[model samples]
Target: MKILWFSNIKLTETQMSGSGTWISGMNDLLSTYYPDVQIANVTIAKVDTVREEIVRGRSQWVLPKKTTAGDMDLFVKIIDSYHPDIIQIWGTEFFWATIPFETICPNVPVILDMQGFYSSVLDVLYGDLTMQEIIRCFSIKEFLRPSSSLIALSRRLHKSVNREEEVIRKYKIISVQSNWVKGNVNLLNPKATIYETRIALRPQFFQAVKWNLNRMEPYTIFSTASMIEPTKGSFTLLKAFREVKRLLPQTKLLFAGSIQTGIRKSGYMRLMEQFIYLNGLSDSISFLGSLNTDDLIKAYLHSNVFVNPSYAESYSLILAESTYLGVPTVATYAGAMGELGSSKSLLYFSKYDYRACASKIISILTNRELAVKLSIQSITFSEKKHDPKTVAETQFSIYRSVLGQLNK
Candidate 1:
């Protein structure tokens, strides 16, 4: 079966990142495991590497990101050329990605892959940062820049949320990853048919370095997001870390992205910079900027615990990675983590409650036996859910089912 994919990232790049890595992995997997299911990808990225059907086994059209009517028309031509049995749009997060809806791909069956809505995140974008904290973090210079200003960011996100909601409501079929997403999707468009599916992680995560207690830094904590935005819950994590340090003085917090000196940071990050020094956590926090998968796995292995402080998530891929590798995890009961940790796979606390967050982290740190038990449970669940074979099969079946329903 010919399947056309509309993606936000150029998938075949040497340095794969985030959701793109898993999508490319699944594309390759579907070809090998289900040989009949052929795939093609059209990505919106800075690079322009356009290959046709004959040039590559499957066409990968990388269009320079544009949201014009002309771009949509050209996309139509590409779709006509490929003539896929089904068109799968990866996410509803971007304006460029909203092109291949039912209106554009009228004749074919299109399934919107539900990858967390910015509309849902828009509400918690400040990530539990109170008005007083906001007043403290406010900067006239940063606000003057327009792009990094808190007001400007909110306006842009509001626009994004409106577009995302419209796109989702128009699409009839969607693939949901978690209960949180399913709930949100129903609210946006209750008439839409929702299929629950699991995302496959990159191959490296499945077979990479495992997190063991023996190699862990005594009190090191790892977080995948550098808290580039408030939605990532950096402020929440930082508040929790302060409390954690007061109790366990040796504790260290490590961020995946660079929060280094001599860098222009976001409004939230600018606040983070001030808070770190104000709290005397200069030595306790470290940043590793832009990690490839290998380095990321290493960081995860070396840390004592993994924390996902996101106020919301469709599914935290790193959370999955950490759990899959049996790394002890603590997360807020926001978004899907509650459902994710329902099996007692990981520990949880109330969202935005730094004290509860600290308490949960402390529980994991102090009880080696409980940590090991949580790790094993998480590993057991993750092994089945993210098992490459299961993931590939589930998606392929969804495609087949989508096609089957069209006939009915």
Candidate 2:
């Protein structure tokens, strides 16, 4: 079987957005596992490496004018040349992706991997966009029409929107990560199947050096995620860290992220610097700018605690990565993050309360024995649920099942 993997964003080796990571990983895994299946991807050029196929198009967020219809028409021709049995679209909101599939490849089953609610995501990514632009950014005109199937990253996300109400009569499935998706899917669409696609740790990540070194410092806390400003809750983390610093002067807090000046300057970064300077924490507070994955793993290993303070999270991949690195995490109870933590997996804190948040960080930092115990349990949890080999196998099974259904 041949598949045409349609990406919503330009995916390049160096540019690793969450959706881009998922797309590239899926492409590689599908190609590796399904020997008989061939896959071609439609993507924007990330670099000048291969000028082989350039489909000049405009992005709503990046470009000033609507992409020429002629350019998109050429894109369809390129896709048709691939002759795919199925078309798997990564982002559901972009009309450009759906238009060609609907008009040109109607019989070819298309799967919409609604990575997340695009409307909510747009607001998070581009707060400067007007309400009208936000509405235009994620119009459901294309997806609301009947499609072969719709896959949501989380069940709560599926229920959060009203699109299912309009499309369920024709919608085949809305799969989530674990059993939690099944209950919500049944409630949302009694006819829909609740499926699991587990998140995994890449084997390459295992090569990170593990530091089980004993430290004399009473507490060292660390947090890491994409540097995007609105959604990551860096503000909440900074506030909490400020409190922790006040209570325990000896404690060190490190904020690490992969962001440069051009991208959305995390408002928190500047504010954090001010807070550090104002509070005289320049000695204890460190802003470790983005590191390679191996270095990130080292950060996880060396720190006594990990924290994810995002306002919303589908799954805190950083928390999972930290768990696999045998580090305890303190995460907010947001979105699918609750699944990542058990009573023993990591500490949980209310979303906004700085005092409660600081308390949890302090408790984990001070209790060395408890931290070690949580680390062991967290690693076990990660191996069972977030192991890459396990996740790849689960996804491969789903691909086969979907293909089988299409054949029928």
Candidate 3:
């Protein structure tokens, strides 16, 4: 079978984010197991002028700007040339990209991989910020160039939000990573068929490694998020870390993700920095912006505990990756994280309660037996549920089922 995959995220060898890891893992597994199947992974790149070029050994179709009719025509041409048996579009964020293909190939099977909805994300991220604050945050041109474009694109996509019912109504299958996302899609289109699939960790994370419970870095904690957003609960983590530091003066926090700085700094980031300064956590907290795979693995190995204090997540790849590495975790009962790790493997805290969060982390850090038990359970859970082979087989089954329906 020939499959054409469309995604907004650029696939690169050095990519470290969740979406990047996901695509890379899936591609590797499909190539290894389903050698007879032909897969073309396509991504869109912004260019000064419109053209097609091979970027980093992958086909990148360049568009002059966001969502244009010309780009849609080019995509249709590519699809016709490839003549794929099935087309899988990665996320609804790029809903505009899928419309033309769906229109042109009415008979061909189209699968929509629902990687969380943008509308739900906006609702959570902007839940607390006022409309004025929202406008201000998006208006900072120099610092928020990417964000500004995102906001503009979201507005254009908003028109399709309600129209999604009609678009998805025609699709034979919709794929989601977690039940939480499945629930969201059900609300959008009740009759649409939804498949719940677990995301697998990369092969590198499954390598044999020794877990040293007795020899841990003294009072160190690690946490990671894709970007500095209000919904990531960085401030909540900071508050908990401050309390933890008071109880154990040697406690240190290491954050491994992109933190906005300079004039482009978001309000939440500024607030977090102010809290750190006022509480004298300048030396206690460290921001390690965007680590590569090797460095990220090293960070997880050295840390005594991992904390995930986010307010929401569709499915947290970082949390799964950390737990798979046998690091004891303390996370909030938010989004699909609770679904990812069980109470036996992960300790859950109430969201936005710094004291509660801190207390849980402290309990895990102080009790060596509990930490060791949780670490073992964490590995056990990951291996049974999140192995790449299991995930690949599940996806392949879905593809076959969809194709059978198409033939009928």
Better of 1 and 2 by TM-score: 1
lDDT-best of 2 and 3: 3
Question: What ranking of all candidate models by lDDT puts the best one first?
Answer: 1, 3, 2
- Number of the top candidate by lDDT? 1
Q: What's the lDDT for all of these models?
A: 0.79, 0.59, 0.74
List runs of model 1 lying over 4 Å from the truth: 13-15, 47-57, 67-70, 100-105, 258-263
The whole-model C-alpha lDDT of candidate 1 against the native structure comes to 0.79
lDDT tens string, model 1, 1-408?
A: 899888775666454765557677677677667978878887766645544432136678766654443466777888888899998888876554566445767779888898887876878867787787665555644655766666667898899888888888888888988888999889989999999988878878876766777878768889976556788888888989999999999999999965534435566777787889999998999888778888888888888889998888778887888998989998877787776655478888777888888888888888888778888898888888788888889998999999899889
Cα error of candidate 3 at position 151, Å:
11
**For model 3, what is the error of residue 236's alpha carbon versus the real structure, in angstroms, after optimal superposition?**
0.8
Pairs with steric clashes in candidate 3? none
Q: What is the C-alpha RMSD of each candidate to the true structure, in Å?
A: 2.3, 8.9, 3.5
TM-score of each: 0.93, 0.74, 0.88
* Highest TM-score model number: 1
- Tens-place lDDT per residue, model 3, 1-408, is 888787776655554554557776777677677767677766667667656555444454445556553465676787787788888888766654347665787777888887665555555654344566455545344254654433554574476565555556566678989988888778767887787776866767877473568666858999984335567777777878888988899989998988676776755466556678999999998889888777788888888899888777888888888888889899879778888779898899987787888998998878899989999999898778788778888878878888898888
- lDDT per residue as tens, model 2, 105-171: 6677666444544334433443232454333332232134322111222233444454433442234
